[model samples]
Each structure stands twice: as structure tokens, then as C-alpha cells.
Target: MRKLRELFRLRFEAKLTTRSIAASLGIGNGTVCDYLGRARVAKLTWPLPAELDDDAALTALLFPEDAKAQAERPEPDWARVHAELKKKGVTKLLLWQEYLEAVPGGYQYSRFCERYGRWLATSSVTLRQEHRAGEKCFVDFSGDGVRVVDAVTGEVRVAKLFVAVLGASNLTYVEPVFSEDVATWVGCHVRAFEYFGGVSEVVVPDNLKAGVTRAHRYEPDLNPTYADLARHYGFAILPARPRRC
Candidate 1:
């Protein structure tokens, strides 16, 4: 009731438009009009205080025609359920059946499975660490490269050279360079990072000449500029070990 009175006051005494007031209050203009209509019908006076606007009274006035109250759903106990599922090869279907049996009215099988999947995704840690927002980036050259012919010199150069992809958003940054020298590689990394709007925690690269000095089966030495770039970006580099197919 008091909110309606305030809305009315703002409309009449303060001389503010309904749309402006609604925007300020983060509600629709039609909502403000509805409140004003209700206030006028209830024969409300102006200058009503905030304490007089009880939510129950406002709800009764706003929705006098409706009888059914909104349903309040119970919160699920995920910790206990996760603990139960972690033991002895228990499956989600079995847990869902248990949930249906335990609770008087619980989620149906489909909804139960969906909710459980979401819960497992948030709770469990898999082999590959989950990529957080703006955390790490991966850079690699595509296996295939496109060629372009120079019109004047009649020399052929690869048009598509290197492709850098952010691990989190899958945003690609591409550049064409003559060769994968240390300078070109470092410059590419700098341009890619600038394009991404921020630096990533780590850069995962394959054993390439520009970045990796000595590609061993276990430990690989990073090129000097690559290390300097890592220092500039406050990130670490992990080169993939050589594999014989």
C-alpha cells in the first residue's frame, strides 16, 4: 500500500513520468500504472510512509482475484547424495530411485538425471582441469597451410601460418608469418594476448623450433624469447613431448 502511495506521489507531486519512475525502480511502466490504479481504487491518501507497505497487504491488493499461492520447492541435499554415489560403483539411476523413495515428492527421473549431471559437473574433478574464465590459452599451427603467390616476385608464401586458440572461450587469433623464428613467434604471442584482452596463466604449445630449443622425450628447453614472453605475461609454457607414430 505504501509503495503504491509512493508511486502515486512520484507520479503526481514529484511530476515524474511513469516510464522514468519504473526505470529507476527496475520495473515495467505498466506495473507502476497498475499500482497507481490499485491505490486510487482503495481510496489511499498521499505521503504514506515506508513501514505501512507490508508485502502481504500489497500482494492482497495487487492480486485480489487470485487464490492459489505460489509453490515453494524444497532445496536438494547434494553433499549427502554425492557422498552416497561415490561409494562402491553406485550409478545415478540407483541414486535417483533412492531419492524418489526417500522424499515424499521429489523430482521425476528426467529432471533428477539432469540435476544430478549438473551437480556432478560442479563437484567432480576430472583428468583435464576445468578451464576457468580467462585462465589459460593454447596455441598451435594448423596441420594444413594455405599458399598464396606473390604477384611481383613470383614467390609462393603460406597465407595461413599459425592459429592461437583460447582454451576457455575457443576464441581464435591467427597471423601469417614467413617463418616460425623466435622473433616472429614471440611477436605472434604478444599480438594474440593483446587480441584476447588479457594474459593467460599458461600457454600449451607443441615442440616447435621457434618456441622449443631442445625437444626431449621428457624435458624440453624453451627458447630465450619464448621464456621472456612468458615472463612478460606472467605465464608458464608446457611443451608436448615428441611422439613416434
Candidate 2:
């Protein structure tokens, strides 16, 4: 039940302001202003048509944008949105706000989420683990090392690949180091966090000797230095089970 007809009467026939109408009908001032603005835009008069007596019909007439078919609404670039989501600190709500700025009245928040989910389902096979934004980052070393030639001394060294992958976005950060020592390992984590622009809540590291001193199924022992790094960064270390990753 609505007093839309009375609202129109109060504005046009009674020469009342939107605030006055809102006061009379116990409605919000913003709502009264919105209704009046829509009526003005729709070129509606004081005495609405008999057909427009129904609130729904009157609303549809005044707010034609809401009456547009769902299919007619603008669609988001799912690939771009998905890519943007992989960046650290990016969320659906933030992306949706940006989308509204670009395409006003495109889709409501709920519809945007539903459609994005449908797109994700059709796009690729995802891992069962649901990685929330900035939640987990998986770190490991590549098996094969690359040889690096010193510029000045003409010395050859095998550089180990320190790999860090964000669980949610699958965005990766890689660096080359000479060894898997605790200093090198902790340095890689720091640099990876800098690259990602933020630290994840949890760091999932493969049971590297530098990071995990002893690997146990129930409770792996993290290297003291690595544990200190975790404490400094405020992230939990969840070492992958030995031989399981």
C-alpha cells in the first residue's frame, strides 16, 4: 500500500514542498524528493491517470529505468573484473562500486555478485579451497635453478627461484636467490609482500628446510627465524604437510 497518489496531490494540487509532503505522509525527506524528481522527469501531472492509480503502475511510469528488462541492462567485463579481483585488497563490493561509477544503474549489488559467480563457474575449473582476498599466500622454491653469470668477475652461480603465489588470485611473485637460507627465505617473503602491496593473513609455505625445521602432519615446526618473521608481519604460518604438496 502506498500514498503515491496523495504524494502527487500534495505536491501539485496542494503546492506542498517535498519536506512538507514527507512530514504529512510520515515518509523520509529523501524519498519524497526522489518521488517528486521522478514525477517531474516523467512529466507526470497532479491528477494521475486512472490506469496509474495502482502504486506499482505509478512507480513503473515514474521510474522507467527500474522497469527496463534485466537482459537490457549493461553487462560487466567478467574477464576484467576477474583479473581485477586477483589484485591484493580487491573485493566484489569495491569492484561493484567502481562498476556503478562507470555504468550507472547497471546492476544491483546482489545481481552483480550472482552474475559474477555464474561467470566464474563457467570460466574455469577452480580449486576447492575458497581463498578470500588477502587471506593466504603460498610460497615455494622451483626445482630447477637458473645459472647466473656475474658481470664483473665472470663467475657462474645457480640462482634458486623463490616463488610466492596468492591463493585467491593466483597472482605470483618470483625472485632469484643463491641459497635457501633463513635470511634468503625471509627476505623473499618480505619482498613478495611489498610486491603484493599488503600481507596476507596466512602464509602457506612448502616445507622448505629454511622455513620449516621439522615437518609433522599435525604440527610442523617452523624455523625460529621464519617464526619471527611471521610474528613481525602478523601472519600465521601454515607449512604444507611433508611430501603432501
Candidate 3:
């Protein structure tokens, strides 16, 4: 077990990274992680206890749980488990508990997850994100700008592209404005709602100065004009705050 000794030395003495240790010792990354986890659980250090100086003793000490032959538990119905996971606020731990109730001899949470994960990789498609119809509209500005020419002076200006998307259908409304000032920002929302033929229950906007005057966590400040537009349409303006996304 020369690799095991070197693993301990690299971890506790040299403090090399897992990737570095794996590369240096010619072992797999998973093996390195397993060894490190066992060492931590057994309270092992670089200079192991004198009793485990021998190879056999060290292996036994590190992997006592593996030496005992445990009987296999019943496999979980992963398809049902997968379906349960899609419901809002349902977690793996909760599903595992429910599984244990149905089959008392079923696998533990860790193995249940491992087996379920493998089955999901082979059998399931990625989850679809569903938004409520007319519940919310997400609003943002496109980074790219379009050209605007004044008819009288023939002066050229770069205009910001305002964009709005209805959450359920992803219906989009776009307009090029000279600036993102309060008036233009409010006007864009008005036009967007008119184009959509209805107002969403909530209008989510980026925390720009024209919409969110202050980005405080507890109490965000919305611009008066933007707030007034929301009031007129019977919708609420919700500005995305820092660290919320």
C-alpha cells in the first residue's frame, strides 16, 4: 500500500491538491477522494499510529465497514422517485424516507441516490421549467445598441434596446429608445402591455436606476414614475435585488 502512505503524506504533509496527488501517485481522482474520506473518519494523520504501521493492519483499520459482507437491500422504483422529485419543495431525503416506508429493506439514502442518478442519466430527459400563465413578465434591456438618426440635424445616436418577455408564452416586445430614463422606461412598459393585450400580475425588472432607486434587501425603492405605471395597470413592479438570482 505504498500509494496509501503517499496519499497520507501528500494530504497531511505536502498539502497537495487532490488532482495533484492523483497525478503524482498514478491513481484515479475517485480513489484519492475515497482514501481521504476514510483517513478523516479513522482520525489518521501523516505519521499513522504505530499499530497500523503494518500494511494489513492499516487496510483493516481504514476499511472496517467494507470487510463485513452486508446483504443487498431492495432496489428503489426510480421512475416513481423521479416523478416525485418534480413536485415543488420535494427533496431526495424526503423521497428516500417515503421509499423506506413502502419497502423497509430498501437501500440507504446515499446508495438510493447513486442508483437513481444512474437510471436518470440513461432514461430521463431534462426537466422543463413551467411558469404560470399571465402571472409574471420578465423585463430587461439588450446589451447591443441600434443607430438613431435625428431627422432635422442628421445627428446619429446609439439607442438601447428595451425587451420584455411574457413568462408563460415567452411573447417578446422590443423597442429602441434614445435613453433609459424614467419616462422612456415607463413608456416602454405601457407599450409592451398594450402589445401583449393584457397586463401580467407582476412585472419583473432589472435593478436599474430608472426602476429601482435603492437595492436594499428588505425594502427596495421603486421609481415613482415606474411605480405609477404599475398602479395604472393593476400590476406590481418587482425589481430583482442583489444575490436574489
Candidate 4:
């Protein structure tokens, strides 16, 4: 549901192309189009209604067919459940069983997890920091990919998404590449820098295999090609700490 809201934000506020949005979110282009189509049919716009903030509410409004079934089931206090999961030795399966014990007709384990995930997504928040212009650029790849098929041979391949964001402005650049090889990674960075019209002093990237051969807290090993790219661009490569989250 976070992706759903971001889909609306990317389309209405950022004004990115549908394909770009699909790539950035690592969803299919058809999926992006379908979401937009549903939004149009529902007459939903950016800064969605306060009443529609919850995933269940948004889902009910967007896909009304399942509303009755969903409403019939008793829902757990998701806020409390979310907080509890943070404690040691607590898991979703245990929580779901407890919920069922309390409410005999409540959602099953699968449904419980599904609802919890949706709620988690909608309730998630991101912290932003202020930085001097051109000071830092953060980059990462989406977890999924978009499919691309050959025109004549009909060979299908997955295109990875490369996303770069400026620290100060939160300005973003996204591109789809056939692979995450060192060359492709470096090329994407160059293009992103060009898109921003300048290079940042530091490039902070997630510990991607192509860019960082080995991730470390104090010092990370950069791929030779990636290192050369940094040298040529005169920007420092700062790989994000491994497993910090």
C-alpha cells in the first residue's frame, strides 16, 4: 500500500513517466498502469483523503469487492502488535495464534501477516536530513525488476532499477539497466550525475555487489571499475554500513 501511495505521488507530484515509476518501484509497467487506471476510476488524487490513510480503508475504497468479507473479520490492534514484534522472541506466527485464541473468527495466519504487512507499510516513516548542495548523493537498487522482451527473438530479460537521490534536495534519478555489472553500475552513476547537472562530493551507495566487493564498517572494498569511476569523477565512494539496520 506504500507503493500504491507512492505510485500516486510519483505520478501526480513528481510527474515521472509511467515506465520510470515502474522501474523505480521495481514493479511491472502493466502494474503501474493498472494502479493509475484504478486511481482514475476511483477519482483518487494526490494527498489522498485523510479517511483513506489506513491500508484497509484505502483497499476497501479502491477494491470494493472484498470490503464486506474484510469487515466481517475481527482485526487485532495492529499498533500494539507492531510494537510487540520488536521485543525478543516474538514472531508473526505466535501473534496470529494469540489473536485466533482471543477471537475465534479472526483472520488466519496468512491473512494476519498480509494485513500486518500492509499496515506496516502505510505506517512506516522516513527521516530526512539537510545537507549542503552537491554534498552527497545516495544510491540503491530496487529489490525487484521490470521485464524486457526482445523485439524479434522474443527473449525476455529482467531490467534492474538504479536509483540515485541527492541528500539536500531529495532530487532523484532513476534508470533501468540490463545488469548490475560494474560497468553498468558506473554508467548509471555517470548518467545520474549528468541528470542532476553536477557531481556530488560524496556518493553514498548501498553495499551492492557490483560496487562494493566486500562491505565493512570502517573500510569497504570497492570494485576496480567502480573505484576508477570514482577517481575519474573526483567523488568519494562511501558504501553504507553492512547489516546496520
What's the best-to-worst order under lDDT?
4, 2, 3, 1
Which stretches of candidate 4 lie above 4 Å from their native place? 1-73, 77-128
C-alpha lDDT (0 to 100) for residue 9 of candidate 1 = 67
Over 30-120, each residue of candidate 4 has an lDDT whose tens digit, in order, gives 8678778878889996789899978778888776755776678766898999999988779999988899899998887888897786566
Candidate 3, superposed: residue stretches over 4 Å from native = 1-128, 149-154
Query: RMSD in angstroms, all models?
Result: 16.2, 15.2, 19.9, 12.5
Instruction: Flag regions of model 1 displaced more than 4 Å.
Output: 1-129
Candidate that beats the other on lDDT, 1 or 2, i.e. the better one: 2
Per-residue lDDT tens digits of candidate 3, residues 108-176? Answer: 889778757544533422334568999999997777588889999999999999999998999999998
The Cα local distance difference test for each model comes to 0.70, 0.82, 0.79, 0.84
Residue-by-residue lDDT tens digits, candidate 1, 114-233: 655544433433343457767778887664567879899999887547788887788999987776777878888889988988888878888888888888876788898889889877
Q: Name every residue pair that clashes in candidate 3.
A: none
Error of 4 at 78 (Å): 1.4
Clashes by residue pair, model 1: none
Q: Which candidate is the best by lDDT?
A: 4
- lDDT, residue 70, model 1: 22
